[model samples]
Target: MGKSQKKRQMRRHNPVRVPDSHLPKGLEAASSSSSRKEAILPILQKMESVDPAERKWACVAVSNLIQNDPSTRRLLQGKNAVGALINRLSDSEEEVVVEAAGSLRNLCIDGGFDICAEMYNKNILTPLKSFIPKISTTLSEYLENPKTAPENAQKLVYEFADNVITILWCLSETSNKAMNAINQISLVPFLMSFLASRERLPISTVTSAAQCLYVLTDENPPAIEEVRSNAPYSACVLSIVQSREGLPQANGKNKEVADNRGLALQVLCCGILRNVSPIPPPSVAATVDVDRDIVMPTLEPVLSLISLVEASQHAQEHIAKEDAIPALEKLSLKHTPKSDHKTPSGLELERLEHKLRTVQLALEILTGVCATLPEPDFDVQDADGEATDADGDEAHEDEDMDDEPEVDMAPDNEAAVKQQSGSNATIFQTLVAPLLTLIQPTPLSFPPLNGPSPHPPTTSALSAIHVSALECLNNIFLSFRGAKIDAPRADPDSGRRIWDSVWQALGAVGTDIDNPGQERRRATWEIGVGVLWGVAEAHVKVLMQLCDAATDEGVKVKCIGTLECLAQHPGSVDANRVCTYFSQRVPEPLLQAVSALIDIYSDETLPYDTNFRQGRFLDALVGSVEGVRKAVRGIDRKKERELRVRGEEVRDNLVAFIEYRRSLGV
Candidate 1:
């Protein structure tokens, strides 16, 4: 056969087809070798199709292309896909609008500053603002006549709102310009109106609106002030939080959904409240009365959650049956022939996570409120008519040393004390009680010091709860100390209970204060300082016990640092009432601990690379000893002499250790 005839026969068997009309207009002839931009340009062209269905398909395709592929995202941006999507947001068809919004939302993901800036420059907000009136009108129509509304309109409305709010959230997170533009459009009021409306919106709608408000108000003071100034807005959020508070705890098919909805509302409300209630300095006069009207009511539901969980756990433990274990094993064996073990279902785990998040939000709100309330004043006066410190200042002062800085231990005036005390008591009852309960650790078996820790470090809801609650307690204690009030006196047995719980949490976490690991150690040390700084002098003995029980060098160092903080702020304790307590009670144990630590530093048999031999540790030890010396100096001559001698000994040991390190050039 001729060569040309043979080629023609081969082509007939396997023909090469050119681009056709079946594919998108510009995309039909594109080959596998086409660049991403080449592939996307045709899709972008198709987005302008006159048919709403075609436009929706085009937008959906664009969204999928950019979802996680950064290269395609860049290609889409180069082809002006964002501008095209923005234009499509106003399409007559609801489906087209939803897809376009989803596409825009995808483009904004991980786009960071550059993409947000691009969107901002392209004026994305204009189209976003236009959706507001349209959504509101459509929602109004749907709510008015649900049965007559367009089929699937309810779902579309929620998707549209969710997408719009998510876009705004992403943009606000990335660009200051976008945030400012959102603020200028009065977005807070617009979003708050949805939340505040009498019409019953979908849970998703309410959640989206709340989330938008949260993102808008985060570190944006004007927006926060806007929400705070709007009384109806604040009331609406409170109502949502309070309304869900009464939701009955039930187990059913849809129970998880209900719990999630409740959690979303609660978290958003807490965020709003936290943003509005700025923590003022202790000296600033309290402007907002958060206790009776807002805080106590807000806390009632949170406390109820705690009680519910405790009750549920208790009931689970006490289920009565003669052969409960064997019956359960037999049933399990029958139900699962292949495996005898069971794990929490996805829904069950999600529900648990939601519960923990709810508790965390509640604790965060309580912390914010406690920060704004005035400190309680617990100082009482003597018969001499002079305003006295909580402890008798005169009895503790030594006349020989005439140059000591005069400590102002007199509490706030009478009326202020009475007013603050009531509010403080309310806070104690509402906030402190639940927090104390949440942070209380269940007993866990731990390995020995030389062995690996049984509980490996992880980020869980319980861990978050512990960290947040400790932070709240720290703030509460600081507030009390600043007000010259004694926490123990205000709530009789509560102080001891709180102290014990804090100690337990500290022990459970097993923080190595010298070589802290992960977030847990940081949180543990924060609680440690809080304990020493807030707990009264009468409980110094308990503080000392923590120091003695600590095995980790880091923990021991933190314990010493806590003592130094107390000594640095001697006026925190009642000098006159606790004069003997400090001079007689505390100095001996404190000195002993210091001496033992100093001996550890001085030990020649220990490895030179040990943390004890480190300069930072020695420096901290010296500072602690010095703090003790200064703390006792004014209380009594005998105690002052004893502390000074011990301080010198500790200093000498630290000096020797430093010299030893220098000799080795370490």
Candidate 2:
């Protein structure tokens, strides 16, 4: 009671001193201010008798005071104030510089713009111009000999750059000379160097640079043109171009390598995507997100990287080819701005569609070129008119280049092993043919998430490629309408024995068989899907093959599992196509079996591969019932009405399934 009474008395006597917004936005900002303007002005004028602590608070008070009231605009007219700020920009006190910048920003408001303009007009730009080169040289020296880089240097660089960018951005429209002066400082070089550093620069710095440039270029073209012509801006552009080629090499870890590669792709995408002048497919285009202010010209160099993949594929450099594909996909992955976290829409979709079309075209080119390679071909090119990896890597066993047909379907018994070795002779015969034919290596990593770290951690590329390939595959599968892809089929001449053999081979590889001499077993799974999406002239037959394999005891269960997972791909065959398959390939017994499975296993863990289809089938069943009402409109009204009632029953059943699963936490 005594402690509570004391606290109540204290609350009655004192309350918060400042209005909420009048308080500085941050810890340092608050600490840098005076308790009052009268107290603040005294500190601003002090040349002596001040502790660093008092000086820090004085800086905050000054910045906050100016921000809170326009009367402080006259501070610029006071030579002492402007000089103090400029000096404090180089202050040993971090708070001092932050506060100085804040105050300066306020001072430069229209009433205060004249004060800064007067300095620039009277040759203040000269000091900034002279000072920047020294700063740049110092920063460069630190980069070259990092030991020489000062403590808090990144902060210094950011402040210095922000000041210059803001000034130029604000003044670019005033006169050509003002713009020219801005260009002479070579701010672009400094900013680019910041960007190129593997070390993460502060977001504040990057943001300031981006905003300043967007304002300068978009609002005042002549200023931007001048800046571009200057050595600094040109150097920045060149650094960006070189960075694409400097993708970090993978270490032994495939996953880590994939991740690092993804980072490279992100940089490239961010760099190139701004130049999205080309168009995209409408539905595909619907997914693009556009918000950042990066302009088209800036995107040009990045787009060139995609062409590099095509060129490398032509040249036969496997590593290069691999790099280019993943890189392109990464760049095309959805990019958004930090200022706003929202998906792309409207015109942005059109822009995305255009970008996607280019990617699609590139995929076609890559697949076609890869498919045309000599049986054991590498996807990269070397400058010296020499080829390597065409015979496959010497580290691995090689097969003769002739005499083979579809995969070996039988188990890898000694005879099956011998058959596989024989088939390997047809090195060009695998499913890589179609994948290499239709899909472009994705350059985008994951969909847009967080931005890069202080340094891009090294293990991102492999994950990027795998995920991108999956997404692209999903999209490609979805794109499969009823149209037949012009792919080669198993020979009808062999009474479909070749067709059966090929599938057997597919099943064989998908099994857990030991093939010590196999070049790649995943090759089997990849090729099957490639044919399904790209060259399936007989969609109904393939559907039957997949269904039979899933149910048949003779086929290994894992093969069925693989097909089940593949079906989840977004681009996997469309739901409409599912109906077509249901009509043609789904037999009455199988439909009944599927329906039975749902009823019996409503709350159980479905068979490994069957889970996906099970859920889909339930939904399909519901749709089928809905179709009853429409079908009975003109004829068979009584049956239509009956089916409509039955449809409601099916829908109700599905609701129960969902509720049941929710209860079990499945």
Clashes of each: 4, 48
**Top TM-score: which candidate number?**
1
Q: Could you tell me how far off, in angstroms, the CA of residue 535 lies in candidate 2 after the best superposition?
A: 48
Q: Give the TM-score of candidate 2.
A: 0.29
Report the C-alpha lDDT of model 1 over 462-554, residue by residue, as the tens digit.
Answer: 555665677677767666655655656555588878777778767766765433123344555565556545655435545556766877656
lDDT of 2 by residue, 1-666 (tens): 000011111110001111122233443444344333343446565412245555555454444343323223343234356566556656666555555555554444322234456546555464455556765776677667766656677556556556655555555444556766676655555555555553455544554454344334433445444444454443443344334443322221222221222323333333222222122323221133321122122222222323323422322332222221111112211331111111333223222322332333223222222222223113222222233232212233346634666686566566754553443223223323232322222222111122211111101221222222223332232222222221233333332433444454455334432332121234334544454443333333454465665655334233333333333333322221233334222223222323333344453432221332333544445445444334324335375676455444544565565456446533
Residue 28 Cα positional deviation in candidate 1, in Å, after optimal superposition: 33
**Candidate 1 stretches greater than 4 Å from native:** 1-127, 144-148, 169-178, 214-221, 224-290, 303-352, 375-412, 440-463, 489-497, 506-533, 536-565, 568-666
Candidate 1 residue 491 C-alpha distance from true site, Å: 7.0
Model 1, TM vs. native: 0.53
Q: Candidate 2 — which residues are off by over 4 angstroms?
A: 1-37, 47-57, 71-80, 83-102, 109-123, 147-157, 173-177, 198-200, 218-666
TM-scores for candidates 1 onward, in order: 0.53, 0.29
